[model samples]
Target: MTTAIYWFRNDLRLKDNPSLMQACMAADQLLPVYVHLPNLEQETPWGFQRMGQHRKIFLDQSLQELRSELRDFGSDLVEVPGDVLDVFEKLRAQIDADVIYCEQIQAPEELEQVALLRNAGFKINPVWQSSMLDSQSLPFQMQEMPDVFTQFRQQIEKNKFRFAYPVDHLKSIPPLPAIDISSTQSLGRNTISTGGKFQGGEQSAHTHIQQYFERRLPDTYKQTRNQLIGMDYSSKFSPWLAQGCCSARTIAKQLSEYEICCGENEGTYWLWFELLWRDYFRFLHFKYGKKLYSPKGLSKHLGNEFDSEHFFKWSSGNTGESLIDAGMRELKKTGYLSNRMRQIVASYWIYDMKGDWQAGAAWFESQLIDYDVYSNQGNWLYIAGKGTDPRGGRPFNVAKQTLDHDPDEVYRKMWLT
Candidate 1:
């Protein structure tokens, strides 16, 4: 009787999960688990809850739906409260599972988790399934991939490479092991927000994309993607994508079909382009790894020093720069921010405020429901001129940003009041 543990990482949904499917095929009895990392409960170096209320509430919502889906498969999701090793050690004692299966995360910390588990005599399998394009299918080896975004996109287009298609959802998960999940292990009650702009889960993700396409939003994505306010202006798909409620392949496939039926235009092409950008960041991690997390990043330039006072003002929406303040407030309150506004606010923090980019990124990490580690780190490094393209850094003029994106003060007024 084979018993194996299937650990849920960022890839929360069962649909299109190759790793989960592998576990089902290999094991007779499966124990599905999601570890609520203990670190999230603590404070960051910048002095804020590592995981803020907005993100925690969204994650709980995602886990709730995942649990329901697993129940439908005659299995249950055991929410364990601890770090990877502690959680797995306890599970091993309970079930004596044969192996562990999970989606591979290329980030340093996640990689370290897997390494530690393997060193401790755990048989682990980590599958790489997060990006729209599989790393193996890229035109060049990951290490040799272009440093510039345009070069990466050109290679993809030049070779006519497209997205990896999503797989079907498992009809049934393997039955649970005989061992029962103790009630003591639960991560408390699942957080349910009274009302919020974003709800996280597989069902919510699919419903959102269905409507987004049905409304023909892609037709205008290029034009409206840069808008400062309103959901209709952008895809608004990041929150779900970040949490792995939806896979990039699923979105890309839907986009391809949308193009075939509705006819591809600048809008459709641009959406795909954005997806490529996301893939670029993911692949870059393969080459750079922990260096991306460094204060100097890939460059020799020393990053700015942290000023607690400036950080407070910028993060709390009290910076007195109307545009930056409004964006910060929206992110803190709604856990969502327009992409255009993100670059603007980040630029302001790095340049005008002369603040530490690492602190700025940490604040975003704390607040954004849509925060993906790769993109968050990559973008902050880009703006601070500490990344691969660290050519003098990206410094946006607050005056120009204000005039260009929020001249009407409509966005500013909406949040400031």
Candidate 2:
């Protein structure tokens, strides 16, 4: 009987997972595994934990939910903590599995892991399913893809790009080849209060999407998405989207249905526009590769300086600028901040505080439960004037932002005091 390993990475959910389906098709017996890499606890050069408490807690909740879902299909997720290479090496020896199926992550480190496995003589089949539009369906080839978001969006819209229909959940998965999991220890199993509005899981992701559409949230999304507070201000899909609890295509598909039922408006269209932005960032990583992680970023703009003191104050919500402080505090406390707040704080770090954008990006990577590498790096680069933005960089006036967004001081008081 043929055996294959379904290695879960960012793409955690089974529903709408093309890679998981491919794994099931290739093997009569499957080993579904999630290796919580030890690197998560290691510190970055910026001197912060790679994964902060907030993201760790959410990831734990997500893993638990994934395990429960796997059980329903007569399979179990092998929870292990260690180096991914080492864990997989042992699993391969035990099961004699030669093939591994997983999602393709374009980020440098993630790509490195796949490379290591492939070099070790394992056949790695990586499906590109993270974006709303499949790569093959794009009007231009990957290399020929436009460098700017506006150009990319225009071409995609002109070509009438469509998202793939989400795959259905498997009724039953292949039985696991029995192997000892005794050496494996669960990484995020400890119960901890998330203290955030969002919960992690495939079920929760779908439920949230259902409710958002049912209540016509998309119709008002354009207007309220920039708000500093309130659950209904935005779709709040990023955390789930970041963890792969839901696919961007699935969200886009639902939004299309919502528009058909409720009559299309600018609000509903804006949500699609935002999804396009997410797709753009993901594609940008593929186009630029390792440059996204560098201090100079895509544009190779030099002269960036690291200021530990400024970063510490900015990250700890002690930046002294009320708006910047409020946003940082909300992120520190909730593992979340509105999209508008993210831009404002990021601009303040890069322009106002004159700190290294890479340090700021690393801090966000450590903190955000919803942090996607592409968006995090892309946004930082944009703010630092080292990205694809034609305007060079964005500099938000903190005083004006405070006056406009929080004139009543309601948001400021809630987090500052």
For each candidate, give its TM-score against the true structure: 0.97, 0.98
Displacement of residue 133 (Cα, Å) in model 1 is 0.5
Pairs in steric clash, model 1: none
Q: List residue ranges in candidate 1 displaced over 4 A.
A: 182-195
Task: Give the lowest summed-lDDT range of ten residues in model 2.
Answer: 181-190
Scored by lDDT, the top model is 1
lDDT of each: 0.88, 0.87
The sequence of per-residue lDDT tens digits that candidate 1 reaches over residues 165-242 is: 788778877889877666625444445561357788999999999999999999999999999887799998898899
**In the order shown, what is each candidate's alpha-carbon RMSD?**
1.4, 1.2
- Summing lDDT over every window of 10 consecutive residues in candidate 1, give the lowest-scoring window: 186-195
In model 2, the runs with Cα more than 4 Å from the true position are 188-191
